[model samples]
Target: MNDSADYCDDFYNYVCGGFVNSTLIPDDKNSVNIFITLNDKVTKQLNTIISRPSQPDEPEIFKLAKSLYKICMDTNAIEEQGVKPLFDYVEQLGGWPVLKKDNEWDESLFNWKENIAQILENKFWVTGFFGFYQTIDIKNNTRRVIGLSDYNAGLARKNLIKGLEDKSVLNYFNYMVNMSVALGAEQEHAEEELKEALEFEIKLTNLTRPDEDYRDQTLAYNPMTLGDLAKRYPYFEWKKYFNYELSPSNISVDNDEIIIVSNPDYFDKLDELIDSTPKKTQANLLIWKEIRSLSGFLNKNIREVNGNYAKIRTGIIKGTPRWMKCTNTVSSTFSIATNALYVREYFKKESKDNVAVMIKNIHNQFIKLLNSTSWLDEETRINAIKKAEKINQFVAYPDELLNNSIINDYHKAFENFEMIGDSYLESSSNLDFFGNKIGWSELREKNVPNMWDSFATRSSTANAFYSSSENSIMLPAGILQGEFFNNELPKYMNYGAIGGVVGHEIMHAFDDQGKQYDADGNVFDWWSNSTNEQYKKKAQCIIDQYGNYTVKEINMNINGINTQGENIADNGGIKAVYLAYNDWSSNNELEKKLPGFNFNSRQMFWVAYANTWCSKSRLESQKLRLIYDNHSPSEFRVNGPLSNIEEFSTDFGCPIGSKMNPEKKCTIW
Candidate 1:
């Protein structure tokens, strides 16, 4: 504890000051927090599993994952081959115009529209001008449909809007120039052509909307027939593009078929830009995107150039070690296999059972909180309870992970993919095609509701998620270890740490966004108009409360509208879990006090909760997150939630109007 600061004044500092003051952010990372520190342990465990020599008797998925890791780790092969593999890949894409001298390029040969469809079919993963993928139809969550939206830009919309004035945008331009030049383009020519490409990207970004602007799902969800879409935005031939992209999966699209255009205006704006901009500039941007996406996977020189851009983007002084990079890539790309391997080697059944029990207790506490909330009408209150009861809890790894048949079926898309181990670039390209092929293939199959296959893409990570489409909360095996949970820790500490996370995820079902989805996970309104108004009023209090908190380092207040859902979850989570912990303590015998502290069990609980968010971050990362991240900074995450809970003030004996004991506290669950 920091004796200099009082607990009531700054709960986060009092609890986390010692660690934050003493610890340094790792050179390879932009921030160091409890979550990041614990994740390092999980990565080390995965590295041990993936680095083992491949076994002949292992499952095909296991062998494939191991082989992919082996290929990524072979720096000698990558360095020797140099950029030749990438240049060859580019030749197949009808050539990057910037690579050729001005007059030598044949613009007639390169059709950006046809090239886009070809890349989508062959590469399957990289999204250039537009994005097309399967998503759960919001109104009918029982099935998936193709959703089209604007491209995921190289720079974020927020940064791109700043034009060349933004340092990140400037760095991106430099990265583009340097990368094209490395591929044998003349420096001056590459810069001149790529400058137009960069400007085209900025123009495209302006046409698209920011994520914060689309919080109201109705504004974003526009279901249109393929025929209608073709008639409305005729510049790019939507019908032909869809047919070409989906033909590889043997899924045909007719004129009457329905697809969700998430951003309808984007197509209109895009058509205008397509008509005005030169085809050469558009082609350069398209290929530049491909180059940017594959740069990190190329030779050492290309990777160094890529790493330099990352340093500016994330504020890291050094690049991550190669083994760690390869490990993370393998884990994400082969998530199902990684989950199976992680569970078989490390996770215990007892931990799963224990977390399940905690989830049940916290869930019951939330229902009780809803029952007693005076602001909610009786009908709304009852429906809220039913929704809470219906929430599915997926604790630790799914049972399907233990079955080889299911694992193999999940990996059937990669049936044709083989790793030659001679070239990482070729292997990576094939993996991208096969891996992303699964998402496109889903369009052919009706989504089986409440199945683990749809949502278990990432189970071996140190995180928790509440999926609105599934109406479920997933507590992955990765989060069950380290500081988050322990078998031998006191019930209070365990309840305070992981229990808070469990409660937070549960509360999300009633947050601004999640509340829109009903118990069936359909986008239906279950609340009465009167009750809805009351809920909004309560939410506004939270919005205003968090909006006032300024991150002094950045001189910017928190984007309360952007982060309201998370703040609500954080507050409601701690509140429900604390009461649940009290009930458990009352029934069971109170555990003996610890050796170092004189505080009671309740006080220790709050300290443990705060400790989970203990962190130190670089200024650059902090600025970036403040602008984009939905969650508040680590310090605010602790203090912001605690300050609003009267239970915390009473336990700490904080005065009625101290910083931690505000006169007005916002509570909405």
Candidate 2:
């Protein structure tokens, strides 16, 4: 798609430099777009329905997703049940003081905050300087809230507070000191106990709050209650930890349980670094974050020494293929009892009736971009068209995931679990203790909206989201297909690639933290103090124009107020699929030059939206997604919204101040 280059100087490297110079990037991927090439064709169509064949009247969710994909492709029953079930679950949680031996130490029978609240209620990987979970209460949206917060650290929070003296966070603690000497320790006591567990996660990244200062969704909502977080942080133990997870099921948190303190200055500098460190450096940083999140289900040399710091922060040499991480751990913990056999084998009802006519022509081109915007007013443009007619365009899968008595009553709500073909550390410890014991017995007897078993374990993700707390948008059938959706391309290249990703997730229901949630998805604030000060003065002119755009291939700079709500849904999703393809080519016709490209259908609709954000990455995964991605690079999500698109300089005519015709332009739909 070079076509003599210059689409007003840099149309995303002139149509993503021919698929970022014909793809490649893979040695187990660091980048390759079009949602990782249709999530590697939905992981080779769920590895042909997880290497089929076994069928004795199958269906108990495909025999538990083929016995958790043959217990993660039984590599000699995980190397003859090696790292002895991770050293017998670290000698029942009282050992790994980095391979002990120092006269069998015991800080008076250590409890390290009740084993860091049972390693964050049995999830394991939850890093230490705080993090508890159980969300959905971004401002009392009823039920579920928990939080505890502040944790990001495993490295990169500006290299644990040195704010970049770089050495890729000491080459990720020399790959966790070669995974604590491949789980045996003693290579100089595994490099001084993994450099004192990387200086206790650089003192919990200097006691928190640095994800671009918590992208202010109303100053990161606080809330508190478990007796005002034990009188606002009286050194841990929040009521024997939420009465050891809701008073053994009688479900009562004793001091009016509300717990939302979303980082009161990260518990006032983590109560001065847990009252000046050492109880053996907080028991070697919660036993090095539960033995580095259960050392990649142990064995194959502790999964390549816990996959060598994601191949030194994302060059990704290997990992994730133990039968696609046991078919993505049975498609993300039995996604509503395994996404109805991945939507009855690779979803398609003519691609959900042509993506429900492109989500009804991108919600009538976002009501003609809120009837051609004017910093919104007429009663905030009729409550933003009654919250875009109650958004909810779910798309690709979920129709109760093709209901087979709700996938056999969600696999008979885990009727007596079993994985006879044993070991992936006992099928990931019997599916993490019977999927949290039938997810707290169906969240204490029948809670609803079963996200098709969490979208059947991220069915090879080619994601699309919006949720707002269910105002909905979803999409996922792994982003439909290749260059983002297909039913045979042209309707302006599927309205410039998946109708500009269904108008960038229906313009993320009016961005900036989804305009503080509304249309029944609660957290209410339906605009109007002069349309919320002219929508924060047009979201501070797109946060001072993408915060003076920098990211020159990860040299870094673009946080733009924590990526201004996905750069306002990537400029109102390429102007709602370029005004829903000029209202469907004002009665259809325009498709002509893409075969041997000469760029015709309006420069092939911006080269199918910059070749669906073509590939290339790995400068250590673009400096670890420039400190953990929010989105802004993919060449500023296509030249920061086609340089404030005036129908992209009148269909590439440009001239009016070249460089894609910029002249103080930063709009917000």
Give per-model CA RMSD: 2.0, 24.3
After TM-score superposition, the amount by which residue 606's alpha carbon in candidate 1 deviates from its true location, in angstroms, is 0.7
Error in Å for residue 211 of model 1: 1.7
Top-scoring candidate (TM-score): 1
Clashes of each: 0, 6
lDDT of 1 at 475: 89
Worst 10 residues of 2 by lDDT: 117-126
Clashes of 2: 6
lDDT of 1 by residue, 1-669 (tens): 677889999999998889878988879999998688778888999999989988887778888889889989989989998887777767766689998877877788666666642322264323377888778899998677888888678877888879789887888899899888888889999889999999999999888888887777777789999899889987777777777667766778999988899888888888678779997898899888888878878888888888888788789999999999999999888888887888888889999999998899999999999988988998888888889899998988778888888888877766666785568877777676665556676686777666876446666779898988778998888899888899999888898899989999998999989999888788888999999998899889989988999988768788889999999999998999999999889999988776798889999899989988988888889888987799999888899999999999999999999999989888886
Candidate 2 residues lying further than 4 Å off, grouped into runs, are 1-61, 64-94, 98-102, 105-199, 203-283, 295-329, 333-340, 345-348, 351-353, 356-425, 429-475, 478-501, 505-540, 545-561, 585-665
For model 1, what is the alpha-carbon lDDT of residue 634?
85
Candidate 2 local distance difference test against the native: 0.71
CA lDDT of 5 in candidate 2? 77
